[model samples]
Target: MNYDDRRASPRYPLRAFAELGSSDREWAAHVLDISYYGARIALLDEYNLCAGDPIRLRLEIPEMQVPEGMLPYLHLEGTLVHQQEHMLGIQYEPASELDAELLKQILANLNK
Candidate 1:
């Protein structure tokens, strides 16, 4: 089967625990793939995460492997842009300068 790749930035496959929610709700999820712009996460539990809804993402990162001085988690605010069954697609908002650099470093390490 043939598939078209429409992503502006390449995505790296990563299996990591993550948290997705709003101020009032949160759910356990596993990150399947990630890029600087967004990520695709599989829910560990049932929830109603819909497109256009604001959400916060907290993804666990290995402290030892990350660039020095970076935190052990990726925390960002985003919007749910798509969903399929148990997976939710998140589009991250403009993040802090540090967060952006950390994401770049993380992606580089993942691809190594």
Candidate 2:
């Protein structure tokens, strides 16, 4: 079976900037696509990452409007599931309610 067929939810293509951090390291990345369960990203620079490595991702979705006093970014925790050169597939861990709501809002805007 295809690897994508294992996904439980559909992915939405998103052209946005993001920061990916693990331990003391951080790298600039571009959001390729996202789903409720995970995301695929391309790093701006080459970096060695193995599957199952913990990663913290902060996505800056410029097209998504947010209410006053709210941040315009989404913070998420995930694990690197696959890698090919500078591109990586990440599987999200369980999210907080706030993060989950924000993800829903982002997806809604993307579907428009």
Candidate 3:
């Protein structure tokens, strides 16, 4: 994808495992494909997601998911953007200032 496009993007490939959550519902046991403002997460069996569904995310970074498996955890509030097969795509809500800044940097780097 072209980072210079008006669309938001990520700097580097962020590979991590994610657990999806929502008010009154939680789905765990899956890895997520993450970027700056969104993600495509693989769901475990028995989970059904749809467009317009709001969600929460927990991303476990590689180092955290392997070896000692710690740190780089992320808590995100987002909404479903799309879904295909077993993958659920989401767009993050603008919540924390820190997260917004970080996402901005990630996209900026992608332009380089």
Per-residue alpha-carbon lDDT of candidate 3 for residues 1-112, written as tens digits (9 for 90 to 100): 5323534764244555677887777777464445677766777666666799888887664552332332355567889877777777788853566555544544454456
Clashes (candidate 2): 0
User: What TM-score do all the candidates reach, one by one?
Assistant: 0.87, 0.90, 0.66
Q: Model 1: per-residue lDDT, tens digit, 1-112?
A: 3211655688889988888888689998899999888889998687866789999898888666577777888787889988889978888943578777778888999889
Model 2, position 72, has a per-residue lDDT of 78
Whichever of 2 and 3 has more lDDT, that candidate is: 2
Better of 1 and 2 by TM-score: 2
lDDT (tens digit, per residue) of candidate 2 on 70-89: 57788899899998888899
Question: If the candidates were sorted by their TM-score against the true structure, best first, what order would they fall in?
Answer: 2, 1, 3
Arranged by lDDT, best first: 2, 1, 3
lDDT of each: 0.81, 0.85, 0.63
